[model samples]
Target chain A: MALSASTLKVGDTYEEQVVEDLKRTQLVQYAGASGDYNPVHTDEVFVTKVAGYPTVFAHGMLSMGMTGKMLTNYVGDGRLTQYGVRFTRQVWPGDSLTAKATVKAIRQEEGGHIVDLDVSTVNQDGVEVVSGYASARVDP
Target chain B: MMLEIDPKAKQGVQLGPVTVTAEDIQSFAEAMGDLNPLYTDVEAARAAGYPDVIAPPMFCMRMRGGRMLPEVPLPSGFMSLNAGQEIEFHDEIIAGQTYTITSRVADVYEKTGRSGPMEIIVRESTFTDAEGRTIVTIRERQIVRSPEKKI
Candidate 1:
């Protein structure tokens, strides 16, 4: 059954399972595949000394990817139409990151239903590291 | 050998006026395993208030994915890693629209840690539609680490 836009409402929150301890190796693999090998992500010393981070951190895109996965899974396949994000802070390794999306509004336009989502990522400290919005066409 | 880039020296160094097409967006969607309707379904998109099918938000990165050559003038080594990207959208990117990108080196800094020395480069990109209207602005940070440092 397709989930309709009307079924979703404002203040609806969804959370993704916390992956324990995002590793440096994962950052390396993302760097290898995505061509981002910035030292803050791969070099522990550089991350600590230069970036002033405690340890190497995860790539912003990697965190975005996880958030994207949550949306794709919740909205169901092919329902998401437009999505965008902004980086607010850096995500460090060993930090428990949670991706959350709240329905902001639902409107009828162009013969379909458009659902706008307020999406964000919060670390264990409850600080939002990334914030953005996504729009999707849901079954009316 | 560590390649050092003075961020101040390269400020506003435009890296792209790269043109992108609908086909490229489609190909990238496939590569990323994203099978969203908006990326592939025109009728569905039109019904959703879009004038036409649109690419995923992250699809903009593919514009820079045309394999860079070894002889290319990238500041670092032959290999370029995609450290990460940040995007802000002003409008949807539709099919058949020609887009141009302009990127500049934003910042460069060094850090030493348990592994070794690492160089960080921040690149800012502006993407404009065919009409010259800015569609999105992105800040991509790339970290180039010395290969000698092994965790």
Candidate 2:
């Protein structure tokens, strides 16, 4: 069902805590699924030996997808007109994350009602891993 | 012999014609650990007014299902990371539909920040549905730097 605009205030918020902390194979699975085979994401030995990193880190899109989950949980899939994020920090294994989207504005646009949101994801350290915004059409 | 990429590798390239399937949508949602019914159950979607179950907003990122070339090639022994992303959703994507996406290296430059010398490549991708309707536009910034180049 379309979101009930009458009930969502400008400051209303929706949040989700990821069920899994960081998985070891997520990057490789994502690499296979997304086809972003950048070795920095999948090949740990390449990173540790050549590029020099402790181990494989989470893909920014993985975290963004998690944040997208948070939004979809609240607004449902296919509801967003625009959603974006800037990678702020790298996410390592064992780091827990929380994604949040808070309603920022509500207005009318041609064909539907538009709702703007301020979005963010933070890690266990409370450091922002990614931050951005989204605008969606909430059919009334 | 490593990853010394040619900067031209990513110029005005066509990325995909990946067909969206129920399995594709499901795996992505599972990877994201998001079981939102709108992306999982067709009946649930029908109950919610959609003709079929749809993909999440971020699903487009994985729509590039093949080897996508980079606009600016990086030297081996260097690592790259996503700096940021900007996306505009123009339309909804439903399962069993196919979407073609084209991408180009929009910009390549170097910046010395709190970190150090870093090469930044900006890439733009546009996703269009089978009927030629625009679905989404994505802009990505990738930061490449030598592992030793730190503050």
Q: Best-fitting candidate, measured by lDDT? A: 2
CA deviation > 4 Å runs, candidate 2 = B1-11, B46-52, B66-70
TM-score per candidate, chains pooled = 0.55, 0.87
Per-model tally of clashing residue pairs = 11, 0
Cα lDDT tens digits for candidate 2, A42-136: 78898688766787778888889888878767775567888889888878877899989999999888867888999989998889988999988
Those runs of model 1 whose alpha carbons end farther than 4 Å from true positions after fitting are B1-151
Q: Quote model 1's iRMS.
A: 6.4
Q: What are the per-residue Cα lDDT tens digits for candidate 1 across B1-151?
A: 3455555435444344555555655654543445577777778878888766787666665554423111114543332344445566667677777777766666767766445666666677777887889887777655565433532
Please compute the TM-score of chain B alone for each predicted structure, in the order given.
Answer: 0.76, 0.86
lDDT of 2 at A5: 69
True contacts kept of 1: 0.04
Top candidate (TM-score)? 2
